[model samples]
Target: MSMVINKQLPLPVLLKEEYPLPPWAAQAKVRRDEEIRKIFTGESDKFIVLIGPCSADNEDAVCDYVSRLAKLGEQLSQRLMLIPRIYTNKPRTTGEGYKGMLHQPEPDKAPDLLAGITAIRKMHIRAIVETGLTAADEMLYPENRSYLDDLLSYEAVGARSVEDQQHRLTASSLDIPVGMKNPTSGDFSVMLNSVTAAQHPHNFIYRGNDVTTSGNPLAHVILRGGVDKYGACMPNYHYEDLVRLLEMYEKRPLENPAAIIDVNHSNSNKQHKEQIRIVSEVLHSRNYNPKLKKLIKGVMVESYLEEGCQTIGGEHIYGKSITDPCLGWEDTQRLLYKIAENC
Candidate 1:
């Protein structure tokens, strides 16, 4: 064989068996799950906010961030349903750079799949137990999702992988809310088609077994903006763009015609500081139009204990981002309070 077959890590079942959630944590998860699902089903008028670092690079920092968010969530429970983002797997555009904690638990160390897996699981469990918060992680590797699916409350299919057959199929099987982002080309049809595929039943081979899924009704869309032919970012989270998406959704049969705007990606042209302005503009649009508010369920923000980003292996800041620039804790806190007031 050309590639080496490394030793296999424990399966998701065995891992959970060994480190199962406590009864209290499990009950908390159930309550949080329903609360989040209600937003997708339109049963709850509260807006959902998925905010955290771009990737969970450090367990201590990530846990601390979620702990603070958990406190804020309690106070804003009536207006906002905050789900901390614990994205462990990052998709590199050219298959390079730090591929998140799942690839290398330590930023300076070499890749260790086994250790990475254990670290991610432990980090997620700790967040829930320590803060009573359920998180949202990207489904970067469909097969790897099984490792964390039981613990995640929300999932996202990144723009690069939205059209993949395996990703769509795996999303179909998930019971929780899954957000499918528009491709880099900004093709809404491709994203909507993925949603359609996810919201209908399908049978596919998975993990050496034939698995059939009844389909996930909560699968929805995420607008992360797009890149132009000249490689410039073209945002699609504007009022007109949202109206266009609403028209498209009206034609589709997807159960929950909703979208969550990603404020830090191409939408803000990767300018992390633009996140605050973007949120304010989107909120203004929601306030101006009733239909738009009904279609936009939430916003996804990249934030951490510190602002901006640093190259990996450099003099790293304690809570700054390693993958992308993010909003600092103070600004993030101010923005959250503002959003609550608007809500």
Candidate 2:
């Protein structure tokens, strides 16, 4: 057998019991959820800024960043809705390297899933309780969602996972807003098909039981551009790309038609610093065609306390990213203020 059995980790339910969110924090999560869901429904005009480190590798750094966001949020409360991108489980194409906080809570330590579950749950609770700001996390592992479900306000399906059947089905069940990204292949129809599937009810086997989802009307599209067969990046965040996506929505009966542009990834060709210019261009596009604003809801940015990335090992910088490179804290702040101004 290729696989070896490690000790079984406790179920999500038991973990939740062990690290329960405070009553006040739970209330805060509900309020945050309501505010974010309205953005998809077009009930609010506030722009969303899903900004944070590429992967949340350290707890202290994450909390420190969120605390600053909390203060900034108070300043831009009327114009912007900031959601910390506290992504814990990162998808690896080759299935090697540091997976994320879920695989190893400590960057230099061995994998301890039990500790990981506890660490993530506690960190989310602390973010909510301390800052009163619920977060957005990628649903890299559908089953693991139950572990943080109570605290998360938004969920995203990455470009790689957008085409998977389980991802679509699971999105249908989530009551919160779910952003389905265009697949790595850059197929528009594939992404729209996912949104359609997620917006409709479905019956599927999940977690050892038969379940039926009520359908998620808030399910929408995310344009992170794409990669081609030749291993080159292809962008889809241009003026034409937004227009085409809007046209696609016009042809479908999907509910609350909206799209969020991911400024990094294939769109920026993985150039981290380009996120600043990308955000400006997207805002300009939204402003140029007032109609496009209906479809272009916001942009996702990868940023951290430091400007670039460092490999995981001994003597790591306190707040720099360990995976993909990211914009430093100073740049992140200035860009956000500019976004608020533009919006």
Candidate 3:
């Protein structure tokens, strides 16, 4: 007798059931939703500062940073909104290095995804509930979004994933505001295209099922710089670039005309110190340009309790980043005050 195949069998499982969000997470969701509404309504002119470690590899370090950030946020609440970057998942360029807390919660032990996810969620909840502050994170894996979606007030689509159809659909369905970064290769067209795609209703398959999105009007652009023809990074937040981008948005209105300037990444060429100067320069340039000033909504920066970064597997160092170098606490304070003064 010939053997028969069973086509009805489910695909082999890659992961187990997800852990439910803790009580703190539920409280955080309510708080974040209010802040998101204020941001989109233009009632809050405060520039959102999404500052934290390049990757949240240490739970204690992240919490310490947030505790300090919470105080600064209180002082600057009148002029700026502080959204701590509790980024638990990081996208790799060459797909190497530790992915993030979700992959390597225990530094040495083998990957315990369940433990990692739970640890990250706990950290995020603590930052929001204990510190009483909203948080921001880049959405990398689409399926993992729901785990932290309810707790986030702001979401970002990294340059590498901006043009992906799945991400655009994801953004459209998000209740929080989403910032789309320029393409990794330094193209504004792709960013604008992402905005268009994210702002319009879309019908697509989601998790083995069909779904339709009502479109996300809060989706906007984030000028994080692009690469030059000679392979050098170019900052797109300059007055000329900002003007051109605003003009492009005006001509082809998608979700919103506003944009956020990322002071780190290619914009600062990964130089943590230059982030402050670059942001100040952008502010000065915008002050001189009437139209540009109105379109620029906020700024994004990477900061941590301490300056610079250390290797993940190297000697355990407190406060330093394990992925990208960041502005130290002192510089972060100065930047926050400067932005408030400028406003």
Candidate 4:
């Protein structure tokens, strides 16, 4: 009863037509999707590191960061799959702040949905064609998935959005692996239940039309740590925490019972530097237990060309995060190599 219609944007189909992905890039995406899906399905031993800027605010910087990842991906192709996190959609918990490139293509500029849509599409397409990479994005807005679905190899349901019905249903319809993160409450059952919902067939209203999905067997869990009632970070990436997840998975019928540990977020208590230690420990846990290794496929790292974050509307620092702080490039490269060696 209290809303303003700012503009009637074009549908996803029209947007796709306006900015089409090249045939070669589309083919590349197909192969990348298959390869990444295998990792989630337990068919590949390769580990995935979804690393990049916290929010893809600048096209040139994000692409430059991903270009470096493409080289690293080739260097460790056999053991690691470096999927850059070109996240255009961001969830603002308090309903304010920089919501990501999808809200404003430029961080300091006014929100322009039309230009933002164009910017995100162009950036994603460039990553595929120029760098030979298919990136991951957060499904912050379930209704907007179709806009860039063809370009994404992996998608994630944020801890805040995991419990939403639309997000669960959207994950069910997606063809690529969709990560359902444990909620802020850190309830294992909530995350597992969302995965179950996403792995089952459903007929639902999507984009104002009735749609039926065959269901996505690659729906899995992401442990990003959680927040307690008193607002303290509670980690669950320890060996015992993973063992609990394994036992829970054993009792569920969820397909592709996999978990990706988010190295930043609550897991690191937002200390960007702690990502290195978290990754090392998780990798060690996998080595200690073979079964745990299979269930824990990979990790998500928030990193960029520069270390840490800067406030939006202030003087911009190229390749640094404007949202959450991220690990810097030098540290990221060294740590990635360390992970590959251990893997």
Candidate 5:
């Protein structure tokens, strides 16, 4: 004879959905799809600029910044395609600091993840509907993609997670253009692998169920520099390096031949001011290298209303970053004009 033991089920918790997008979100999505199609079809030669704060912690600040960017985007529509980075989540190196608006809406208080996630989604939707400008964000959590997948024009798989199979698979199914950064060690092989993985169809388990992907044909590469024991930035947008990388990319068939150069992070050696100088350098080099020029599409910069960064758990200064230091609005504007003139 056998005896059975019963376990009690957990109690249900009712949470409010605090953030929801307005009706205009649908129209914005349609425009974004048209823009993406133009980019991939060679109908648009405009440089795609992904610019914004290191992390979007405040909704009002981000909205103000995007409003300004959208106006400038309209003024420079012929030369550049602006995609404001509305990144609401941050991936940590050691699992410390405020992760993003999705984890702590109040900052340093009890976590209200339900509210945080909703807040982020609502903000993303607002960026598109209110400004009529496309948005870009780093996809950290695979499950979170569904929340804003319909609103984003572009997505980035950061250096830290580019090598992960799950992330690569997730990229395959993404509806918008995806950019995969090279590994932290500055190796291009991982990114190449990522591009290959994202270009082909994939089948995987998702949300406790089986799913298949038709692959993201618009997937591309982002050179954000890399680090090693010597702590130097890898592939410094040099003529030789860009030539070699493009050769490799051409030798093997890829979903897309274009690449986005990130002017921040290891590329600028983490110096906020260096972003402008690096952009100028790349533009100059691209002028002489035809092959490199053809493969290069645009650039990425981390900028905010103010320059530099702040302590995450410390007093809130507002408009500054809690992670990496960013270029101020004035400098960011100057850089944009310079790229337009040079490119």
Candidate 6:
């Protein structure tokens, strides 16, 4: 083997026992999960917003940002459903760069997988106990899902991992909603196939056990735009794009048959400020077409305590992102209120 054997780490059950959730937090998670489920099942008319930093690099800053969002959720209770994004693991295109909190809890520190696991679990627990919000996370490593499975109410199968067999199978076994994004090459068929695979029964080898999953009905699509053959960003958040997705959904046996528009990524061309404008355009499209309003459940926004991104390995800004550029809290709050009024 090319890799060195490391010490065995604590399993998910042991870790949960070590840092168990409080009674209030456990009850809150149940309520949040049910509300989110209603949104996917077409029983709720309120819009959903998955908003937070691109990478949760700091414990204090992430909790602070989500605490503010939890308050906003209270203010916009009737119009929208807010699920903070506490992404602990990040996907690197070349297997380099800071791999988020799961690889390095501290941006300037060296990689420590053991400490990273504890830090991520503690972060999620704090977000729920203090703020009463059950956040979302990306399934970067399928086997690592169990670590935060109880703390998270939403999950995302990133564009790069949505087509992977393990990701699809793992998502099938998950009880939470999993948003499968279109591939980097902009292939809708690949995204659709992933959703189908996730929504059907599967028998696979997982954690050295032969497991059978009853399938996840909440498996759905997320339109985060895509990259073209020329390496340019191509957007699919327009009215025509959504209309095409509805057509595709009609042809499939998917359960929920809904999608979420990721306002960042290639859709905004990494232009963080463009997120607000893109959201406005999409909302306008939804209003113009009644069909679109039913099909698009919500949007995903990348925002933080500060605006833009900074390079790692220095005394960087406290709340700015170490990965991708994100909107500041002021802009995020403004956009949320605007969305609430419109919704």
**Candidate 5 Cα misplacement greater than 4 A, ranges:** 1-23
Count of clashes, each model: 0, 0, 1, 0, 0, 0
Model 1 backbone overlap count = 0
What digit string (tens of lDDT, one per residue) describes model 2 on residues 89-146? 9999999888888889987889888888888888888888889999999999998998
Record all residue pairs in model 1 with backbone atoms less than 3 Å apart, i.e. clashing.
Answer: none
> Cα deviation in Å at residue 112, candidate 4?
1.0
- Candidate 1, residues 119-195, lDDT tens digits: the string is 99999999999999989999999999888877999999999999999999999999899999999999999999999
lDDT of 1 at 183: 97
- Whole-model alpha-carbon lDDT for candidate 3: 0.81
Please give the lDDT score at residue 130 for candidate 5. 73
Q: Candidate 2's error at 222, in angstroms?
A: 0.8
lDDT of 3 by residue, 153-179 (tens): 888999989989899998888877899
Candidate that would win on lDDT: 6
Question: lDDT of all the models against the reference?
Answer: 0.93, 0.92, 0.81, 0.91, 0.82, 0.94
> What TM-scores do the predictions have?
0.99, 0.98, 0.90, 0.98, 0.91, 0.99
Give the C-alpha miss distance for residue 94 in model 5, angstroms: 1.1
Candidate 3 vs 4: which has more lDDT: 4
Candidate 5, 193-305: lDDT as tens digits: 99999988999997566999999888889998889888766655666667778988978888568888998888888898988888888887788887666778888999999
Give the residue spans of candidate 6 off by over 4 A. none
115 in model 6: Cα distance from truth in Å? 0.1
lDDT of 6 by residue, 118-230 (tens): 99999999989888999999999999988898899999999999889999999999888999999998889999999999999899999889999999999999999999989
Local distance difference test, candidate 5? 0.82
